[model samples]
Target chain A: MQTSTHANPRALRDIEMALERTKAEIPVLTPMVTAFGPLLAERFRLREAASGWVGPLPVVDAERFSQGVFVLADSGFQDMSAHLSEAAHGLLPIMANSFPAMAQELNTLIAAMDNGALTMDALAAAGFGEAFTVPGVNAETMDFAVAELVRPFVERQAQDLAKLVRDLPWRQTICPICGGTPNMSVLRRIRNDSEFIQAHGGRRFLRCSCCATEWTHKRISCPSCGCEEPDELVVLSDPSRPFERADACHRCKTFLLCLDTGELADIPDPDVAALTMLPLAHQARRQGFVPLAEHPWGGL
Target chain B: MPKAIFIDTTRCTACRGCQVACKEWKNFPAVPTKQRGTHQNPPDLTHYNFKLVRFSEHLEGDVVQWYFFPDQCRHCLEPPCKEASTVDGAIIRDDATGAVIYTEKSSKEDLETVRSACPYNIPRQDPVTKRLVKCDMCIDRVRANLLPMCVKSCAMGAMNFGNREDMLKLAGERLEAVKKEFPKASLLNQDDVSVIYLVADLPAKYHEFAVAGVSGSMTRKQMLARIFAPVRKIGQQVRG
Candidate 1:
């Protein structure tokens, strides 16, 4: 059995600490924290393991590139599917023992995904269409849960493709590996040899919500509409909290939440930071603007 | 990055979408109004309306050209109101977004002093709440990854927002394009305020305070006060 070490142990610890802090700060989120926290930690472990299994992926043609262009073309998909199925099986207790055959179904889904046979239409045809539906849960909520469960396996394939085409000239707003809209934007400070200290300058990276692929994008443009007109974009930030802000575009009526990691004492998991900004999401919705991607926390 | 909004006055159709959207988003109660002989209803920015689309008319050769100016707080880079306010938290500038915010504590401050300090005559006081109010740049929405309601509701592409550098660049580009047709096209107070207005005509053809330097003459004492305001606040903090 290959031991899973997808995320670095220290990073995993940090994520746990962030979850704990988030739980402490928002008591209402305790139930959710208790439910998904362990799963996320496990996912991190899977991601760490996946990081080590990097292999050559087929080059994506720049001309006809789309987010779904890269499909799993290696035998590693089998190992990834097996590992993820085991992970999904571990969740049976928390899932109230529902979806008893989830592991077998997940394996089937993984194989189908690897072979480009796992589209929504295909899933519907295979009678797994309602697999995500739970009695009281909204479709979006259920979809989020399902995505979380399968993310580790999907991330493995995405990581390999991301590495293979890291230097490709990808200009699309969607992720080159998964074709998914970015869930979070992170700003990291740039350090040069002349400046021993970190410079105020930074680059913006868009992280895919589905497969965890990250790509660099223009700092001032809207990721949704590709609005390079600076006049059509706005940065909204809470006066009380200066570290996080929403980059909203007037043209597309879309916004993307961004976190400045350089301002923090310790780097936080982008996912955790995004979750904590649920109040901001509410504020955005009230103003009639939507996010670039349909985020799990967006329903809140 | 510090953020800004660019208003292209040439594109404003005076639909009042921005004005209505600002009120709707802020949830400010409507103030009674009568038609003021022109399409510019309510006439001026009131306590209920943080944003007002001002209308003015001028004769260009033979045709009567109507100008629309959506008036709101400029959210000055170095806000004079912030400098003039003695009350703690009465006025604050968000370092992250460059939004000049008037807090609830502003109710306790001398409203006239804060009002007089503005170069653009933007601030208004709510008679009931006593809180000084202005366009907050929709800081709440902006922080939440949403465009300001005014910007969102504007279908004409007149109002826009983004980082200060990008907005400035856009203003320059738009000004160049607009000047090709309207020789007098210019950007209003681009260097000193978060809201940059790209007007297609002379500044006077718009509202009186459409450009800075048209209002609120600064005394030497006020200038000194503006310069030393930060030091004085810090000194007060130390003393306290």
Candidate 2:
């Protein structure tokens, strides 16, 4: 019996397909993929209807966008809080099931959201403020749940924001839209008639941990700590697992999970791809490096 | 769902790019060979060379026609080779990608029966390791969401790899389109194999083993029983 209820069939099917393929390669990831997959699929379900209810985006100032100022850094973020309470309600129970250790805290957080004692603004502010008093619930647990709740809402808006930023030059390793650090980096396929030569990819794009947004970054530079020295930023990969690797920055003591999409038959769902890259994440973490961004596996 | 490969022979230029790519991907050492009077190097699918571009040129009407058949394991939907195995952990079928894999444990199986059971004559044993080897459908790359080496290396758009339903649909579409020029054009053993070939002419003109004998004694039920017979792998869990 499935613990999570997936309202959207397509979302459930996509994750299932991803899970099957991922399991074929790394049977070791079966447990993690099976556990978190449906939880993420719940987000996919939310995304299906988000476009109708997510409303419109605030117009961007070209100057600020190009100068490293994220879209969410602007004053328009408070308006996104409208859908927060619903997203939190939908995810908390399933997340509690997914993370047994966090279950008690998440259930309490759900009750807080339900009673109107915890407003959307308060949840959103919890991550930013130094002093946050959510009685009995630790700050770290609250922040993680808050980010998860905010994900669907921001992802819906980021779909609209991605097109606007596509032509714009936002080179920061973090997302130009949500300012979230990248959990993964993809080497995009080459342009114009040279695909068969298999030159890997032309540009490096960092995917946002928050809203699933992607922005181009320097292929040589580390997304964390702006480390550009080739020796300091090293790529660790075994020929055995060619698809997934880590770009570890010695200077920052952090790394980014890297995948070359140019070699892949299809661009896999980022979350599913991350599940397969769990071993590489653990490998990097064992070498005394943390992920550039927060992810389920990063903490593990 | 099982995965499949659709090979449209008409689009193939016989560049031998796919053949070389397979060798490189597997890191198989090159074999020394004298010119066999044909472009098909080493003459057949050897233990080291799992893929072969079988060349057959015939004088057709006023033109000298050349047919290139790049051949490998058919990865039969119901592999007779697996059923013929005497050893418990020798031949295995990965249902996920429809790959018929030959493991190191195959050295202990009654090698002759396993080799002869394959209609395509694909299985080859290493003289040293005494283990059977063949194209495992590039299962490693497929698992990693990448195209097979042969399909990835094909520059002429001749080879395609995808889900079984998509390949069947594509094979049907290509057969219909190619039939206009070559009326006898058809898909080879598509129903029984994961690797479906779209031939533009008679199957015999290409190669002797291009298609399986449809009138063979084995019933579909028997094949299904053999296919579903608790297949398992007994070697290193290969990855890309």
Candidate 3:
């Protein structure tokens, strides 16, 4: 069933308000996306595919085919709020229940923002991700950009992503619903607001693009070829986002980005947090392996 | 089991998630595009873009209805494009995924014949490689046990993929559900291809050749050649 709960007028209003706020926040977050350009570039393959967009590039013999796919994946949009909301929903209620006063305080902060006292900058200062600042971006854009940015990073976290993919529970020929691929491979680890035990809390597994099903993909396997050769497959990482890496298999010659939340102090929006690793993607592409997709914020 | 993708136009929000996902999964590139007074970016499919969501608006009674057809090579059971190719591995259907794959061999094939033989006007020639290209249904990914990229990326659930039996079932269910709302709703070319469409109106109302017959049949010689074409391949191999 289509989830009408979020499509109703009130929800639409909330989403619209959220989008407008998110767009406004773009000017503010531009600095962050710009700051981590190399990591993002490396992971996302930020380069021109062709002189023209609609037609073939000057290169031939399917070489451009690889580059083209790389470019699209890099720039693909991801729905940010949905995942953020999903993550936040789990974390929020606990705060509301355990520390009712802090929860009340958080509500007041949001209320102040609703009343225009808390600027997007202020929200960022308070550790809220940029997604809460913008408005108008539907779930699709967030989903695309987020997936584009994070998928490779997540894939890279596991040594042999292909093997990891082979073990995933939702491993099917097509997505159960939309027939898309795995956007973010998650390990079902949920963290409550209490101690904020940043690591090893949320679900653990790979997330599918079609149905967003998060299933267990082994930690050290190629997500594409399922090849078990660690020597044939290598993992590349960025110093900035030490938790993330680009896993490339020499055997299949395909690469997936990976993020190790076990290393982060906060729940990284696989999409937004991945901006720190784009340049690594570019470096990987220069080495000849193609990323699954382009990171969405590459050009922006 | 052979897999198929069921596209329900009625459910499409024209978000182009499938379009982007198809490119992403296939590892195809971004086609440079402009605002052509329509959201249909990059206009039509090309060598790099295997799947394209075509949008057309028409007046139905007093309402202006916008129709979207996420277009791609149909991967016909007997793909005319495959029959048109004289080169080996140029356009071979993977028996596993039933995916009509256009390999590098296409660069050597007679491009005009292959392009013209396509009933859906699909297939574009790459200027540089001189190879023909279209959707391969992400066979590599399918082989890796994942959904087709386009199917995976669709956010609106307009696109679906599964075994032929399941896709047909879903297509039938969608058709029946859609028919109650739109009496003319039906599935297009469900029998001949892996990509089946659940359209909410007369197929033609969506596109001139939205229906299977619109592309017309293969020429008499092409038809005959297609039948004998397989034998020709074996003969050439045996002779060599």
Interface Cα RMSD, each model: 15.4, 4.8, 14.2
Give the docking tier of candidate 2. incorrect
RMSD of 3: 24.0
* lDDT by residue (tens digit), candidate 1, A1-300: 001112444688778877887787667777666655666677676566654343455655654543335433222232344344445445423343233334344444444445654444433222222554433444543454456655666776666666656655666667776567897788765323231222343578888877667777778899988888879888877775566788888898988888885434345687777876666666777777898886654664
> Model 1: residues >4 Å from true position, as ranges?
A1-300, B214-240
What DockQ does predicted model 2 obtain? 0.22
The CA lDDT of each predicted structure is: 0.70, 0.77, 0.57
Residue-wise C-alpha lDDT for candidate 3, range B84-129, written one tens digit per residue: 6667777888887788998887777666667767767788888888
Q: Cα miss at A87, model 2 (Å)? A: 3.2
What lDDT score goes with residue A152 in model 2? 71
Candidate ranking (DockQ, best to worst): 2, 1, 3
- What TM-score fits each model? 0.49, 0.72, 0.44
The residue-level lDDT of candidate 2 at A229 comes to 88
Q: What is every candidate's C-alpha DockQ against the true complex, given to 2 decimals?
A: 0.01, 0.22, 0.01
Judged by DockQ cut-offs, the docking class of candidate 1 is incorrect
Q: RMSD for each model, in Å, please?
A: 15.4, 7.7, 24.0
- Assess candidate 3 and give its lDDT: 0.57
Off by over 4 Å in 3: A1-300, B214-240
